[model samples]
Target: MFAALAWSLHAADAELRRALVPTSRYTPSELREGLCAALLARSSARRRRVVLEVTLIAGVNDELQHAHQLADFIAPIERACFDPRRKSGRTGVLINLIPYNPTYNRLAEGETVESRNDMSTLGIPHYSFFERPSWERIDAFQDALRARGVWVSVRASRGDADASACGQLATNRKLAAT
Candidate 1:
């Protein structure tokens, strides 16, 4: 099982999270608390491995400072999930860094983009305002995490050209319909 934490709660603005994920009922703090509780609950023997995914969006939450915040936020959870008794000495926590995949606007034909709900009203720009970080930036982010001893990996970009990559499933369907 895996928990996709999208962005570091410590580094991201709470209002931005709510605006981006309007359907989610839990606030950032509540989500973090719940994740910790769930991790602790499963920390005992026969604990399951949980990979945390963080999609790095350029200019959004892909800075070096954000990496530090992410490391700090994950430290306690890593400890809670670590099992020394286990022969592998694994923490059972893996962080997967995914580069953002651009998606087309879901507007029907002839619909003006301006007709969509204004995300700026929530004090944050729309999701389209962000873009994928450069490859060098991604490497630097990974290096920062490794420097902090976090088990991290950058997910390779695949199937994006065919709209089958992460975050592209729905877009694939939309394209097919058109």
Candidate 2:
């Protein structure tokens, strides 16, 4: 629904070609391996056109730095990030990341994220912002991505207004029988 709406609004001026399935269910390795395998299998990727990515509702926090660690497994990036906490050493790639945040509350009216962005060299875009970013901040993120010479975007949800808050999508399947 949101995707369709976004298209309705910007389809003429937009170049959103690919999509990443949004979820953190897969471990970073699982995500990376799957993405790499898909890329390897694609003729377009061999031609260096399509880029794989980590989708919305999927990312690693400081504690779960799967995305951070996954970097070492992938090839070298062109310029690497400066932040010590984030993964290190990558300079360039044909495509970079610009993933989305899904754990949003109504409180998310105006906020932004700032990443060191060396990770972007991998052809996977990490939203410079994290966690329920606001529309106001999206432009800065766009500007940052533009500075990197990469296109930018915010992943949108297509179904279910009540589709649980990203990581907050938790439910106990088994209920105590009364």
State every prediction's TM-score relative to the real structure: 0.75, 0.31
Best by TM-score: 1
Determine the backbone clash count of candidate 1.
Answer: 0
Candidate 2 lands at a TM-score of 0.31
Q: What RMSD, rounded to one decimal, does every model reach?
A: 4.1, 15.4
Q: Per-residue lDDT for 62-171 in model 1, tens only?
A: 88987887787777677766777768666766778989887754567796546776576754445645578999999999999989888888889898787678875544
Model 1's lDDT to the true fold?
A: 0.70
Full-model lDDT for every candidate: 0.70, 0.33
- Candidate with best lDDT: 1
| Regions more than 4 Å wrong, model 2 | 1-47, 52-131, 164-178
